[model samples]
Target: MTEGLSLWSLGLAVIVVGALWIYGVNRTMMTVPPEAQKLSPDSNRWSKELMRETYERVKKNPIDIKKHLPPKLDRRYIVVGGSGLVGGDIVAHLLARGQSPEGIRIVDFAPLRRPDILGVASNVDVIKTDITSPNSVKAAFSKPWPASVAGLPLTVYHTAAVIRPGERSLQTYDRVARVNVGGTANVLAGAKEAGADIFIATSSSSVAVKPMKFWKWPLPSLASNYVQVFNEDDFDQPLKAHDEFFGNYARAKAEAERLVCAANQEGFRTGVVRPGNGIFGDVENDVTFGPTLKAGDIVSWTPHVSQNWISSRNVSIAHLQFEAALNPSVRAVPPPCAGRPLLVTDPCPPITFRDFYSTVSTLSVTPVTETYPPPVLMLILAYAIEGWANLIINFPILTKLFGWKEPTGDLAMLQPAVFTVSAYTICDDSRARKSVEEGGIGYTGVTDTLTGFCEQMAVWNARVERGEAGPLKGKGAAAPVVA
Candidate 1:
């Protein structure tokens, strides 16, 4: 009886200590920095009137992505992942600059879904190719170009990638590696075999963002690594261990970037563009804005978080600029932009999560609601979810024994790694903005954050007005809580 009582006492003590530890960590991390607070949006910025006026302005003077496009090159182009966000924009920019539709091809796993891209889809070649399958990639590349642009040099833009920001388990690394790492190698080989002269792959700025350490016991302070300034400095160092990256997605991207850079040669030039976190601008299914607009109501824990965002249009511009810099016809000698990664972001200061919610809430004709739970509680729940997920993933037999199923959608994304990536992140794109002659890509962003968000919201609002907007469907209906 005494031993039973002692065991119960021990269990209760353990629970109490765990609870206290979580509370302490939460208290420490909840203290917002004065500098970050200054970046938060003013309450007035959320006013409906201001947002309506901004929407009006955006509709009146829509961002002219064409004005920022590079001069149309006399070359045939192949954009891998061209049906998606950045790749789709690259195709649009190419067509906008008068590149013949017959001169361009889109090789992607997904079909052409974007309405804007669909309008011109008939004119361009759209091939459904799975990058993970070497044979599929080879066949896609081997497909003949039309006779009109057959003689032109080939420039390939590889923008396809599988994104899972919340997953950090090594056991699940293969899920992302197949596409991000192995698939990149497949595409690289295919591009070379196709006699491509210029190759550029889309990478992520999160490669430089380290994981946050939130369990500092003795020190009553926030995680020292919570605030990050991302640039290309990490590229100069050796790749970090998988554990060092924010999640599997970032680690895979880093490896892919390395392969692309290493493949740079005298005849074939290669480069990478790492777009900042929160890639948006596609009204249908972009990671940032589209999901929120679709959901209409959001539950968030990142009101205090601040990070950089990049529009698809700006990311596309950077790719074309990189291509121009690497083009042998444009440069007399080997350019500095070759075999390097350039960071790109919207031309605006990093804004708090509140700013994003405010913009959507105010601009949308459909009533949008946002609920913020205590961040500490969310963090605790995230750890629990991750632990449960890891158990299910590491031991598949549990499914047979207990009928356990893997988490999906938003629940699957509630892992601890989400907090790390969602932390305050600032991206510096000075190198990319430098002139090509000065050893940079000469990238100039087309729209600022507010204008870009306003433009997208304007489109969605117009859709709602036209009675075309409908409830979001499919597994992608819920937006991941991570930025």
Candidate 2:
């Protein structure tokens, strides 16, 4: 009886000490705003590790044989948002599959916070340039790939955007749009100039038929998120900017989609990938979709329903699949991939908001406090805890030698690694063909394709938790948990 009691006490103590350790680190960690969070020192160091991991997964082309194209167009690949969550996974998959890193180019506005990009510095050519700028976009296209690639044998994988705050005003919208829509235009312009053969674009699944739930949320309290669509005539009402956050991102993306579909060239062809939400990994530590708050009902999602989720890694794989289709050298996947909209998501049926959250709940050792901690103090407290815990875990000798308290906190963010939802949207990927045939993008009937994403999200999340990502160096990771 005494031994059992002692064991229980030890467990409790370990848990308590763990909590204290994280609390100390988090408290001191400096925080950057959502819009401007850059890579920290520790995170940067870790990013190098991620760079290595990413190169391992992404170096190989998923398509072993080019479907029909010649050898010159087969090897070179470029992903614009390679540092972002979804883009990051695509890079990882490529490296893991054994694509030559020297042949890959990773271009993003901001660097990644994970270690994948950091480790592959030697293998990859990381470029920081604004694709919206004609010169910049042209330069990227004109750049030479591997020695084997034709004089300008480059394949374009575009995912750059000037979204969010950048879309807040008409001026902002134009600026942002210039990057997405204008950038694509330039990519084509340069592709033509450089004799590049194929391009694959990351298009949003935000249908023009309906305003997204993100645009509808907090209608009465917060600024409206819905804005004017490119095809406003289709909507029941005239398109207007309803959301402050909606300023220009939607319009730009909408316009960009229009531009890509109209991409008819003599030598080159294009493919578009529309992935529904649930694409969470880590970059900004953001889960844009959640229960009832900001998710889509891919199928029969009523206002009573929650949002949909997708694993960014899976989305990355799907996008990579599209990339493989573009390679002109080896036989890839199904032919006729160019100029097609492939909807990539999950395979599970929908679930209620509550059930979704219950499945992804994590073990948080920190006591929930009602009082709000000041932002500055919060940073201090968070880092203090994180530092102490890392020290204890990485240096166990210190634990025994110094008699340190064992940390037991939300360090196990094992659960809810991806976005946790109480409810989600349902979708149908099978109908996407019809939408494409109709010169539009959507699933057949009313079945939203996002329904498939939920099931895959679990598997992708599991893989992410299996490793400790190091994207940005120098900085401690803010809890990936939703605030």
Candidate 3:
């Protein structure tokens, strides 16, 4: 009787645990928004008829550069969000092109926070401005340029944006819209008021991508599972299609880009540059592949999904080229890229996620290739980890106890989806390359870029050791690492 009672107790405990697990996964862990379910690759919503009509109507006619001369370079530059990775790189490139540091002004909310990753001299004005407030933007722009160049034409690069504000809710969505959409409008207003001649808004390739639930679809071997490479002419997906189609970040960027292009006029030429899966250069002590390289740590992520990555350095160069072509300098030539958003990517074909991770390992002296979990299992864990991370980030004591270091306290990012979601989207930058007057973006060499990126990581790791960067609180925290 005692033996029987013990057996019954064990069975009951097992049943209770199984029931709780199912409930947790279904009710608490799943984070996929309901808007995601409305998407169907085969739906008439994505009709070919609509694509063909858009192709014919929205297609840009060939631009004749011979008829138009390049603009002059006698212009002052304003780099909004210049403290960021892309903006910092743009500042560096502008300096390398012989633009005086005094000629450029960087406006950012955290002007003094970011390190001089690109070695921008202190002479470049770092104005603290809240882009969300028009009054703030006006004040920043009101700061006069040097007396010698006071009357020069103004070229403004508005690259400031906000994303993943700790939680996925209506409030977070509103914040994103305020900064990305409303802030962009303010920048346009400020530029026009300031008599700016040229404006370029930084956008993302995600504007053209749709979120896909890959686990429910066909297996990895199916070609249909992979996203088709998007071209400039594929404007079928409207900006307001659905929030989950590309999430709030992409949606806001799409809206902002539309505004910039619409704001283009006879005197003020506005354009957008959409960079694909930008990674590999960041001055902020955020999570990246650098830590894994240092530890020779093997990680796990989704495999076989295709992704296209563009170097931040290359993106900076593209922005400068577009600005130069519009500045009317004797050295500048009329580039075919203007008045519309152009996709930027490496000339090479998209690579599988597994291959990308392996390439990083290969590039690093301490190699660390990633393993893969079955798709369904990986998705479940992704949902669970996101929930766990969100909970832990709130309680500092809990995080310290478990050994996790999130520099930014608000760590409720859709972290796991980087491997699963981003891997499936691809953007083609052929138009950007062909559109440039020089025939190419000049930074098409991926190998060289990767080598340079690895070197930068080495330097970054050294800084982390010296306590100059990374999360300040957590001394020895460990979290589940992913791509």
- Between candidates 1 and 3, the one scoring higher on lDDT is 1
- State the TM-score for model 2: 0.53
> Which stretches in model 3 have alpha-carbon errors above 4 Å?
1-72, 112-119, 165-171, 215-225, 283-287, 290-298, 328-336, 359-371, 382-411, 415-420, 436-449, 457-476
Cα deviation at 188, candidate 2, in Å, is 2.8
> Candidate 2: where are CA atoms >4 Å away?
1-73, 120-122, 146-153, 165-172, 212-247, 283-285, 288-304, 326-337, 351-356, 363-426, 431-483
Which 10 consecutive residues of model 3 have the lowest summed lDDT?
A: 37-46
User: 402-455 in candidate 1: lDDT tens per residue?
Assistant: 999777788788888988877878888999989887769888898888788888
Residue 93, candidate 3: how far off, in angstroms? 1.0
Regions of candidate 1 where Cα sits further than 4 Å from its true position: 1-20, 35-50, 472-483
Q: Which residue pairs clash within candidate 3? A: 71-327, 71-328, 71-329, 72-327, 72-328, 72-329, 73-329, 403-477, 403-478
For model 3, what is the alpha-carbon lDDT of residue 117? 46
User: lDDT at 164 for candidate 3?
Assistant: 55
Per-model TM-score, in order, reads: 0.93, 0.53, 0.70
Better of 1 and 2 by lDDT: 1
lDDT of 3 by residue, 197-249 (tens): 79998988877765544432223222222354576664434555644534667
lDDT of 2 by residue, 257-290 (tens): 5566467353566767666534454423434322
